[model samples]
Target: MTSTATSVIPSTSEWTPGDVEQAKEAREKLDIWPLDEYNCKLLNEVHPRNYVTNADEKEGSLVYDLIAIGAGAGGLVSSKQSARRGAKSAMITERLAGGDCLNVGCVPSKALIRSARAVSQVRRAAEFGVIVSGEVKVDFEAVMARLRRLRATIAPADGHPGTEEAGTHVYQGRGRLTGPNTVEVNGKTLKFKKCVLAMGGRPNIPSSIEGLMDAPFTTNENLFNLQVLPPRMVILGAGVVALEMAQSFALLGSQVTVVNRSSKLFESKQGDDEAAIILQNQLEKDGVTFLSSSTVQKVETINPGDGDKKLPLMKVTISDKVLECECLLVAAGRAANVENCGLEAANVDYELGKGVKVNDYAQSVSNPSVYAVGDCCAGVPRLTHMSGEMAKLVVQNSLANDQWKLSSLVVPAVAYTEPEYATVGIASEEQAKKQGVECDVYKASLEHNDRAILESSNIGFVKILVKKDTDEILGATIVAERAGEMINEVSLAMKNNLGLYAIGRNIHSYPTTGEAVMGCGVQYINKHLPRLD
Candidate 1:
């Protein structure tokens, strides 16, 4: 998307010499790794070293209608949504406004994954009766550069300029709750009628692993800064990030190995083991390796000297296996960014790993005036869209008397692997059974799909769970090239409380991947409905 960075620049009369000096200091203090041109440009658009706070520009004490403590997906949306409702909203962030998704998680990773997919497609061109090709190569530097470029290009929408343009006061500094209705940021005591805690989460590194802190390792936060692709790479954890990166790097020509603590993949509480195994199998065919039911015992840096140069390689010991790699990526999990935020002072309750405790209304259990959203909120799905949805709920519940419940929302998640794995609602038969709901699973294999067969891309299936003896949809899991897109229909069906029969009645176009979704519906109709064929 195009940025409005130029259009939102503050005029000369609005800023004094003191503000300019503070902006200069802010730029110098900002510590974005590899502070290259692209990153610097991104910083300028989001946090903006020259940004002058709205509080400083206006005279007298100002009390905001809403103050959001982060500028991530949740915070950005919360502040913007509140402002759109004609509330005097203010947002405070210690780092970039767009938070993890824009800077590190989704945007950059997808760019790299798309590039890797292109490489895989080219290598498999002969399968489509296309030959006569030289060595298919990958320029790792160019790939990373493109990723950074894309992030910078899209940063404005979630940055200082775009937020300010949307009528939300953007403050670039750490924000801490000092009281029930006040937050302190950069020596400014900002009072608010209500607050949104959206600091989000960060990549969790296992502290139990010996020598991990001192070892040569990287997280998603800094993984995109690499200019050179390591010849050998090892990843910790088996979640979406770990598996996705493992496959992407493998396709990019790196010898990639993934170490997982559990025997099964996608072992998270909301994970689907069947779908994960399908994706894992495809990753294996692409040259990625997996060491399951394992844990990293120790991590150390060992330099195997070559002449005058001393190149350090990471030595990792997992169970009985020992592996050495030029790079070690830690995708263990996410920990809430709750430290130093003064939750206690704000009468807010929070856990260490899980985030700010909130009720079904997304309001703090301890302080009703304060609400939390995104990864920072405990017991909520840590997805970008989920966060935005929660932010909207927070905006409505806080400002109006709306009783929007978080539990009522149906969430869908996707793991962006080659044959993408997407899941929603109840997840599995066991989960449905435990919830005391009997379910009948309707599955349609892509092998039988006409479009899948024509493209030779038939590797996975679409499986949906419906209430036993009824068409009431409970959940779904899809593993296909476009599973991410296909799962949306199931999510919509469940959200609207529509039965499987409704999907069966709808006409799907001939020869399409989405036919898999319709096929599941067709199965349910054929089993229950009277013969009309």
Candidate 2:
């Protein structure tokens, strides 16, 4: 069978900055991505080959030096590296041309958050002596349209290199391991010297709720794809995505009600419990409703055809009372996408929930010839960027090349909310104490930072944990503006074997969240001084 697919043009090459700005103005009037015809052309250019069809049954058995499954962050990086190293390779995936980060994960959500942040700025504009005339209304449809256009615009970078994309041969289908060192794609047998499994994962929906299946619910994967914003909404989890999404949809004009199974809003008592409480209190004042220590008994849809139109009339029963809303978003958790992948056929070792078993090199235990990376492989932390890094180590070891030191990697985790939280290493003091490590913590609140005060958004803190007798940095946490970018210093320190004192000596720019790291550095360093007699 021939693969006939539509191609997408990159918006950056065709739509210049001037064009983008003009399109924004045109959007005010047209309420769409400039013009429909032009947008379609742009989409086709970027995604030149449509990823709609599954692999056809090709009778030929193609053997390769390396094979990669999945085309997300991990798979793409591994495929590119392996090809560069002279390993004849192939990469397979079953999603849109653009992976989760582009289509449904980070990119789209962040674009939507940009609009949310702008709305938040207007709400707080009174503090800046900027008076508004009428209540700042939200054009939900227009906002969503902008996000879609941006996705269509940015998608080509990941999808197309105008053919001959400089990587492994790409396949459009799900891959299943039919034997050791072999996988089946599109009914074709593929033999490999070695293979890497980067199958990634999916969002989880709580099962305890009896009628939830019948209820209208959306996960992170499908939330941003909604055509209309709900008038009232309920979220079932208190994790990072739930909190960030709650703030986002709330800023974008949704009456958000959060029901968390845990008692605390974020359960963020890792360093300064006071700051977490402050944020929870502030969130309450901003009109976001919250309920803690509650479990969903069941999910019940009010009407069958309620969502016949884009906007739906929906209701859920929580707390023994029917919680009426237009939609329900489940940010409960994530599950590894390992089903029907033929892991059982190859006797690949895996846990039902934790994912495929792997070692420092991201190698699978069941088959020595196979390895795994990203969300599909177990790690101390699971993040897209980290997955890309892990893939590099696996690829290097697979190619027998010398590069990344698998043991010396220091990874950081960031939660992208208005007041972000970034962390690396250990934070659970209780866990540390039980581990028999002598630890002390130093903290600096954002309220004291000049930059945070200047921005009028001082709402976080930074904490440093070190071994009591030594200056070695054990772990650190930052809950502040741009904590995602600010957490790098701590991560570097951990990776390079540097202490908090060295981080304190390094000068940082003024009026920035990064300065908080410097402040934390000084605090931790000062604690190491010789005691007075």
Candidate 3:
């Protein structure tokens, strides 16, 4: 609730009307919303109001070899890559430098999830024959504080200082495309030979839901600012963020309900219905209630005179039921942050829901000198690592004249819920069938794994789809503890065209959870390969 201006910059300059407006603009650029010590420290690192760049001094003479808009993972990587390669690169963003993943999406959420996991682990210690003597308690404030502290600790690497140190000029302002080769930011015009649109996405708050805009609901962007855990919480949408947060809060002692429009969870993407069911069952076991085929009809917030001192109780009316809670989180979906960046001026083709149109090379279809990456690119997977990969691709193609492709890259994704759901390439057998590929599914149930059985954490499976009669890995879906880490082995295999035969040949250590991944390969080998006995 504090103002960033006082702590971020001491206002040594005269407070003229224009100066006040500039200060406001700077605050809006980062949009941290919560001006707490941690957020302010983050602002000081990423978008300090007092920080001035070469663009402000030599606007006309400062023509960069490459100018990347948006300082998220993609922007930072793209501009830094170019800069490191001896290109005069400059990056402009209307928000914090580290982008969504570092600031809100991945970093804070994972920290909070880790805290939640600790709580769950302590509660379930007796199941593992390690009984605790006392009551398990969660300090919600400390959890949030830890998230902020970690975020601020990790900020310097992607902040303006780090970016500039990497040899890319950093500008904190709304970057608008003035021409194919020019970008305008805070009255500073930066000319560039190549432009990269890495302006990430925002949470999609559906306007169709009545009273939702008026209610004090939280999105991923500002969810970390909570001072206390809600006793009762209602989450909208059954996507990755919704399910992840629902389970986390439930583990932390919130009566949580997840409302989704689909008849089942994870029906939209990741096509692994069986794997989705396993994850949903695990979440339900963790005290999360699911309302499938439901939509929020209305939302109402009751302040009870506490104002900013307390979180208002939210009355969310959904299909066939009315729910009340201290917290309402909207995780419906995400929309690209493609507005107000002057895409038209740059002749960039973009859609409101989708993002900037680009070819397989990540170059703009209409303007070859212009490119797009990360969540800002239409139809690309919205993952932090994918953004980084695309950013690297943009740098290679823009600078080195390489034709490294976006389609060629196999992207992996994971929902950091307990028994994490991880998938890559083709997600399920159904998806492979839909694409008319002849496939066979090989599954290794974790209940049979020695490591999982010993840990009393055997509740999921590792399922892989391969081309029929061959070892070609089409896709994989893993639902297990450390599934996120285990899925990388499959991703590497798919990326290199290595088949199940290769995976079967590799030696996995005895009685490990990763044996399940290797077990899938063994199953494929046993069924397909002939024995020379």
Kindly list the per-residue Cα lDDT of model 3 for residues 82-101, writing each as its tens digit: 98888878888777788889
**What's model 2's lDDT at 197?**
86
lDDT of 2 by residue, 477-520 (tens): 78887888888888888888998888888999876778888887
Residue 22 Cα positional deviation in candidate 1, in Å, after optimal superposition? 15
Best by the TM-score measure: 3
User: Where does candidate 2 stray beyond 4 Å?
Assistant: 1-61, 160-164, 266-272, 304-309, 401-407, 529-533
Give the candidates in order of TM-score, highest first.
Answer: 3, 1, 2
Task: Assess each prediction's global lDDT (C-alpha) against the native.
Answer: 0.84, 0.71, 0.84
Q: Residue-wise lDDT of candidate 1 within 1-533, one digit each (tens)? A: 11111223452222122344543543355434345567666777776654667543445345888999998899999988887778888899988778899988899999999999999989989999999479999998789878888998998888776778777777778998899888999888888889999999999989999989887587887677677788899999888899889999999999999998887886656466677678888999999999989899999878632211233488899899899998889999999989999899999999998999999999999999999999998999899999999999999889886999999899999999989989898878777876898889999999889999998899899989998889989899999999999999999999999999889888999989999999999988888767767
Q: State each candidate's clash count.
A: 0, 15, 0
On a 0 to 100 scale, what is the lDDT of residue 354 in model 2?
70
Candidate 2 local Cα displacement, residue 427, angstroms: 2.6
Candidate 3, residue 295: the lDDT equals: 87
